[model samples]
Every structure is written in structure tokens, then in C-alpha cells.
Target: MRLEKQQITAGFIKQKTIEKGAALCGIAPIERFINAPHGFHPTDILPQCRSVIVFASPFPISTLSCNTNSPYTFVRNKMVEKTDQISFLLAVELEQEGILAVPIPCAEPYDYWDESRNHGRGILSLKHSAHLAGLGNLGKNTLLVNRTYGNMIWLGAVLVSAELEGDSIDMETLCPSGCTLCLDKCPQHALDGKTIDQKLCREKSISCTPGGGWVLSCNICRKICPANRVIKQNL
Candidate 1:
């Protein structure tokens, strides 16, 4: 596609995302993630990838504090399902426009993890993708903290073969100066200032289904962060 035509198509994709229930949407050229770790790049998933469409579906902030057994669990689960539906629909829409697009799921891994690590690593880190897409900045807690939705948001992505313009990164830092709330709040101390111990976090936060129901066992890091204070004030 021509440069101008690609831009118009990108615009249409973004609009379609919002119309389909996403609260935020932006584009990220595959070049922006050239240095992404092995097996995590758009090209790694789809070799012909030229652009990435990342979008966010915000959830109620109140539900961040809910226990696994609480009613908010249902709401959170529904949001996750809704995000998948939106991404799938967008991919179909793009295909109808004669653009090849592949939707990256919001939850659930494409395959099993290495037994030694047992970490929950998706093909792409949605938070990092969201940052690159200019939807938000990454917080110290490893969550994408959008100015409006804070860290209480789910992200989805789509890879496209058509060339499209990417959004500039948001350089603004959402973490407060000298704040260690998230690190301190972590029950397993899974987060250091520079990185997160995903194995520890996953083990502590995720509950296996014995019967068959969703259970996010913990979210202390997300709940204690000051990044969401702006959203709180607005409410």
C-alpha cells in the first residue's frame, strides 16, 4: 500500500477498535520492536509483519482489589473475554479490507512454558507493546499505566503486513519520584526497581483450576501503585 493509503487504513483500524469496545488504540511499526527478545517480535509470529495495532480495554478500578472469590472476578474475566473478541473482530475487519492481519490474544499462552522457569510469558508483552504504541508509559511495577485508565487495563495486539505509521513513545513517567509502594507491597517481593521476577509473581498470583473457574490470587503490586491516583482523583 502507498504511504498515504496505509495511514488511512491505520486510522480505520483504530476507529474500528474503539467502535468494537477498546478504550485506547495505537499503531507500532515492527521496526520499533526490532530488539524485542527472541520469539516475541511481530515478525517472529508473522514473518511478513510490517505494523502492530495495539489496543487497551480498561476495567473498573474498584475491581483491582477484589478477591478471587468476589463478584468482581466475573467482571474482570468478562473484560478479558471481551478484549479477545475485539481483537478477533478487528483482524477480520482488516482482512475484509484486503489487509492481512493477525490478532494476538489478551490472555492464554500460545504454548507451554519451559518447565524450569514456569513463567507466564506471552508471544508479546502487551504492556511493552502498549508503551511502544504510545497508549501509555510503563510503570516500575511492570504494568502499562495509561493516563486515564492507569494500570487497570488489558491490552491486545494485531500484526499486519501493510506498512503503517507508528506512534511516538510517551516519555512521561507515571511513577512518583522515590516511590517504592509496588515493590514494598509485593507479597513475594517479586519486583525489584529494575525488573520483575515473573516466576515468583506467576506462582503467587495465578491459581490453577481444579474445577474450572478463573482466579487471580493476587494484585498487590497493581493496587498499591500511586500511578492510578490521577484516575482516582477524577472519580
Candidate 2:
């Protein structure tokens, strides 16, 4: 925790993140962390803390292809496990450095009867936080789309007692140009110009997903986008 200009080094973890298969990483103050989607509704004042470290690990493109048609829970659990493992390791490393850390994708399961069950959905929003935290911008499909990963990434963060002055960068994401194709491609019309309706999207996909796959909805948005498709062809 050196203190000079910016309280933390922006590129330190950024370098490690690449080797660890992280597509992107960034740091923000605990105050800003609480204000993020991961924090859900933040407290009036952030408690004694330093910064929030964010990381994004790319999910396998094939993982997105699998469906309930497989009739096995192994793949589903594997996806969740891999994501939580990445987040857990980051938190552990922070603790080893004598920092108080909280990992996203918390190990706790939400209770169906508990009112706060809805609150736990903020984990999904953590993807949005990581996106704005310099990982990438939210594509039209509402998934965080990176140059290397298209709607195929997991996000996690750590809260520490170290703040980096001037490290808080502006979340200025450049929207893809003339990319309303995803919006128009939505069969359920869940994506409007401003906000998305998850309920409608999920319901509409039920027809395509048999034996209980529609609960999560389809990703036609990413499949139709030209961003990564162009990169793939060039490669």
C-alpha cells in the first residue's frame, strides 16, 4: 500500500490479470465500490476501507452452447464453480496482504422465502460493474462484451482497506456504432433503448428451450453482433 499520487498502482494487478486469464482489471475506492452494482444499494458512507479490485475471467464460448438438452447438472455447476473459484482466489490474495476483502458471487445461496433473495440478484449486476470498471462495455445483448470475450466472461471483485488516490477513472464506454441489430433481433422485445425487462425475455425463450432451459433466456444479441465477429474473421 504505497502512497504517492494515486493511492494504488493501476497497472500492477492489470499485468497479473492477463497471465491469470483475466481479460481486464481495475481498482476503485471503497466509496466508489459501494456505489457499484455489486454493492446493490450502498450505505450512506463506506466503512473504513481502501479500494475495490475488479477482475473479469472469460467464460468458454462452448459453455454458452450447452443447454438443458444435455440432461446433466455437471456443466451448469462447473460454470458457477469456475467463476466463484476465481473470485475466491482474489479475495484470499488480498487477505494474505493484510487487507480485509469481500469476494463477489458470494458462496451463500439465496433463500426462496427470504425477502432479500431478490437483493442477491445484484451478483448479476456485478458483471455490469466489472464492465464499467474497465473490463468492457455492455453490448446490446446486455452482456459485458470484451474484445477477446463476447458475452463469455465471469466477473468478480475484492474490497480492501487501501485507497489509491486518482485511481478512480471515469467509466466512459464507447457504444458500438449503428448496432441496433441486437435490439431488433430480440423476439421477446425485452431490450428497449433504456432498460431491459428480464421477465419478458426469460418467458419468451421458454419455447425454444425445452425441459427447462428458458429460465435464463437466449443470447441472440451477442450472436448477432458484429463486434467480435469481425475480430474472429480477421484472426
lDDT of 1 by residue, 1-235 (tens): 3234345466777888999999899998988996788888778889998989999887788776555545556766788799989999988878877777899888886454767866657888788888889999888898888888789888899888888878888989988888888888898899887688878887888775678765777878888887778777876
RMSD (CA, angstroms), candidate 1: 2.8
Off by over 4 Å in 1: 1-8, 65-69, 110-112, 208-214
Give model 2 RMSD, 1 decimal: 5.2
User: What would the per-residue lDDT of candidate 2 be over residues 43-155, giving only the tens digit for each residue?
Assistant: 21235546666776654454344554242233435556765776677667656655555666632453222243222254325555555455666766666666666555566
**Can you give the lDDT of residue 71 in candidate 1?**
51
Q: Which TM-score value belongs to model 2?
A: 0.70
Candidate 1 at 97: error in angstroms?
A: 0.3
